[model samples]
Target: MGVEERRQQLIGVALELFSARSPDEVSIDEIAAAAGISRPLVYHYFPGKQSLYEAALRRAAEELATRFVEPREGPLGARLLRVMKRFFDFVDEHGPGFSALMRGGPAVGSTTTNAMIDDVRQAAYEQIMSHLDIAEPPVRLTLVVRSWVSLAEATALLWLDGREIPRAELELQLVHDFAALCAVSAAYDDGMAAVVVRILEQEPLEGPFGELVGRLMAIAPTVMEQVVADDRTA
Candidate 1:
């Protein structure tokens, strides 16, 4: 293969290995063997395993960042659900590599790796904000968006371990979680309330946010009954 072709081949091989296990567990010899080349030839293309890992990480990070992008033609809740599905698709495919990138072990702990992770977070944040279509978002609105982004990252990292929760359920729950966050903030801030109102205006009863409303409403009578009983006792 040519020099560029050889480098791309090595990166592809390394990414596959990294996806199966943490980057630290994979060695130069293994990468070279996987690429069907000598260990020294791997060095000729890249200086060491660290460089190779970073290259693979860059590719993964770029893909992960793009997962949050969706066309702004649907209800916000639906848009978010589609984005979540794509995000989980990446996590499901690159479990070990995603974990290493987010959790940070000795092998993957470097300035470059951390920056890539941050870039993914920022990209996700910007995408959500654009979906909101707010010109000047309030401080609380900013907090809600950024916090949801972090929550999504943490949720994916925890889900990678054993994956106890059904993936589809988690995806829908995350959409609900975003709405809940905005709703709670909206209660206190007029700006946030306007944002929630605008989002709900575009939502449908069958959508995730509307489903959350239905679920909450279903238990409202029981909750209110308990509250009335406690008030009478008091």
Candidate 2:
């Protein structure tokens, strides 16, 4: 096999083993034995078990990211539903692979994998914000995007660990939960807008509160519109 092909073969073997057991539970020797190769050959491909686990995780994340990337110009709600369906479908088909990727432990032990997880989180955030019609400066918007992504990822991890629900059922629950959050954010934005309007009318300028309120005010209408749209479609 070519270099890339050989590398992929090793990754495949490692992932299969990882799905059945924790990353640390499967030793390099065990992988070599499963692949019918000597332990030294395994070492040549992956310096250690950690390297192998990292590669397996990268492989899974890349596969998932590819599955979700789609045309971005359509209505935000439609795009989100499409992406969510694709995502949950993947979870159904590749549950073990994904579970292994996320369940792999502390970031401190493997900075590379930690960064990889962060990348996955960021990508999901972008996907969601894209679907939310968020069109603010990237730096300013990161906080909102990051907060929503945390909620989604945490919910997904919990579902992954505990439930074996069918894809359709889980998708319904996700859409319902997200729709509620969208409504709450929309109402908060509207209230902020009223505060900003009060400040702009030169009635009172409450320093940081005024500035913060103004920012939320600017996005309030757009957020409400997006929430209405998502509720209808989702």
Candidate 3:
């Protein structure tokens, strides 16, 4: 293979190894052996194990960021649900690697590694903002989107530990969580309210957001009755 091709092949090999186990556990010798090359040849392509690990991480980060890209032709809730599905798909496939990267296992505190993770988050933020189609989003709106992104990351990390909750259910709940965040924000901010209005205008009753509304509506009377009873007791 040519230089670039060899580098890419090594990266691919490293990523596969990294995905299966922590980068810290995988050594240069293993990478070289996996690539069917000598350790010196591996060094010729990269400076050290750290550089190779970063290259593999960069590749992983790029792929993770792309998972958030969805075509803008569906209801906002559906689009987000699809995005969540893809995000979890990556997590499912790269369980150990995702855990290590997010939890700061290998190359922890490394500026480049942190920046690549931030780049992925920023990419997700931009994708969400584009989906929201907000030219100048209010602070609350931006907060909601960024917080949801973080929440998704945290959720994935927790889910990886035991995976007790069903992945499909978690994916759906994340979509509902986004809607809930927006609704709560809308209650306090007029700008968010308007955004929510615009979003609901495009959502169908069968969509995720609408289903959330329906579920809340279904229990509203009971909740109100309990409130009334508590008020009377008071």
Candidate 4:
């Protein structure tokens, strides 16, 4: 293989090892041995185990972000549904790498790695909240957006853990769950205008005041139903 190709091969091998075991658990020597190269050759590409681990994670995150975040122009709900499915599909194919990212099981420093995860999270949150029709510059709206993003992250991690779930079924469940959250968020937005007017004497709420609060409140019941339904199925 060429230099770049060999480097990627090393990365691919390193990811398998990293996913199968902890970062500290596997040594550079082991990776070199598995890649059928001298330890010095491995060093040529990655300085150490930590470097390889981070490289693998970056590759995985970039692939996932590209698949999930690119190609817009659809309804927000449709886009999210597609993204969610793509996420699960990626995890299904790269279970160990997905596990490391989703669970944070690897020992890689957050400085380099967490940034990518955070970027994707923020992008997803922005896309989701943008779809809502809410009064801008409102407190309730901000809260709703925060709450929905938090809920999506938590639930998605849970889905990652339940690797036994059939891909089709998992996607279906996510769609239903996300739809319910959006509905509740919308309901909350509808009621929030009145709620805000009622509490007008209080501090001013800002940014999609109605829709934000709606999305946030909507996440709670959806969470409850998810737990209950999951329990029943379990």
Candidate 5:
């Protein structure tokens, strides 16, 4: 193989192993063994174990960063549903590696590792915000976006650790959670309220927002009935 091909072959082998195990647990010989190559051949592409680990991480990180990049031309809620589906798909495929990337435990983490992870988070945040078309969002709006991004990361990590929650369930919940946060932010802050209303107004009734709004309407009577009954008793 050519020099570049050899380097990528080794990196690909390292990625598969690293995804299945942690950095400390994987070694140069193990990677070479998996690659069916000599130990020295592995070193020829990467200087050392640390270098190989970083390369593997970078490979994963680049793919992850691209995963969150979605088109801006769809209904906001629909776009979110698309992104959530893609997000969970990545989680399902890269189970162990996905968890390691999100948590960044000190055991196998360094500045480079954390930076790559952060890049994924930041990319997700920016992609979501980009749909809003706001050059500068308010403090509360920023809080809503940032909070949801962190929540999504934690949710994905938990989903990896405990498979009890189905991926589809998590995906649907995240889509609703994001809209709920937006509506909540809008309720407390007029600036946020206007922005959210504007986005939701553009959404068609057949979209995810339509379904969620229908659910809200269907339950409104029951919720208001309890409040009214309590007021009458008082």
Candidate 6:
């Protein structure tokens, strides 16, 4: 392999090792053996184990960050669903590596690693905010957005940990939960309420939001009667 190709090959090997285990658990000698090269050759590309670990993480982080980006066009719910699918796909492909990166297991946790993780979190948050085209949002409005972002991260981790739930169902449920949160947040904040109203107005009836609103509208009367009857029973 060419020099650059060899470097990437080494990184690929390192990433596989990292995914299977942890940073500290994988040694320089093991990496060299895995790559079928001498220890000195591995050192030529990466100074040591830490550099190799960080390089592997940086690659993963870049790929993970890219998955969060989706076209800003179309309904907010549609856009979010697309983004959520990309996010989950990454989790499915790199569940162990992702878990280590996000949760900072003992072997990989450190100041530098945590800082890198924070950068990925901020990038995902900014991607959502940028697409929303929000400016000077009220405190509660911003809080709601941030909360959803955090929830998405936590939910992905949990979803990976327990495979009992199908990914498609999780994605749809998350989208619905976000819509529900918006409705709840809007009830407390007129600013958010107005924003949501504008979004609903602009949303095409064939999109995710449209489907959600139509379904909820259809079920509202029955749901409301059930709630009232339950209250009476209590």
TM-score, prediction 6: 0.87
TM-scores of all predicted structures: 0.96, 0.68, 0.96, 0.64, 0.91, 0.87
Candidate 5 colliding pairs? none
Task: Tell me the tens digit of each residue's lDDT in model 6 across 1-234.
Answer: 888898889888988887666565778898899999999999898886777777788888888899888887878888888988998988887777778888886646778888888888888878877877867777776777778878888998898776888999889778777777888999988998987886687678877778888899999999999999999999
Number of clashing pairs per prediction, in order:
0, 0, 0, 15, 0, 0
Candidate RMSDs in Å, in order, are: 1.3, 11.7, 1.3, 9.8, 1.9, 2.3
Q: Write the per-residue lDDT of candidate 3 for residues 84-203, one digit (tens) a residue.
A: 999999998888888888889645448889999899999999999998898889999989999999999999999999999999999999999998999999998899999999999999
Please write out the lDDT profile of model 2 over residues 1-234, one tens digit for every residue. 766777788889877776666665677788888888899988887777777778878887777777667786643334555666887766655555566566656411467876887788778876666554434523424554576556655556667776766656555455444444444444567643443243234422342233434566799999999999999999
C-alpha lDDT values of all predictions: 0.91, 0.63, 0.91, 0.64, 0.83, 0.82
User: What's the distance in Å from true for residue 85, model 2?
Assistant: 2.6
Between 1 and 6, whose TM-score is larger? 1
Model 1 residue 231 CA deviation in Å = 5.0
lDDT of 1 by residue, 1-234 (tens): 899999889888988998889888899999999989999999999987789989999989998988888999978889999999999999999999999989898868899999998898899989989888989989999999899988998998899999999989899989999999999999888989999999999999998999999999999999999999999999
TM-score of 2: 0.68
TM-score, prediction 4: 0.64
* Residue 110, candidate 3: alpha-carbon lDDT: 83
Model 5 agreement with the true structure over 1-234: per-residue lDDT tens digits: 998888888888877876677666677899899989999988888887878778877888888778888877878888888889988887777777667666676434788888887787788888888888887788888788989999998998888887898888789889888888989888888899888888888798888877888899999999999999999999
**Model 4 per-residue lDDT at 63:** 76
Rank order (by TM-score, best first): 1, 3, 5, 6, 2, 4
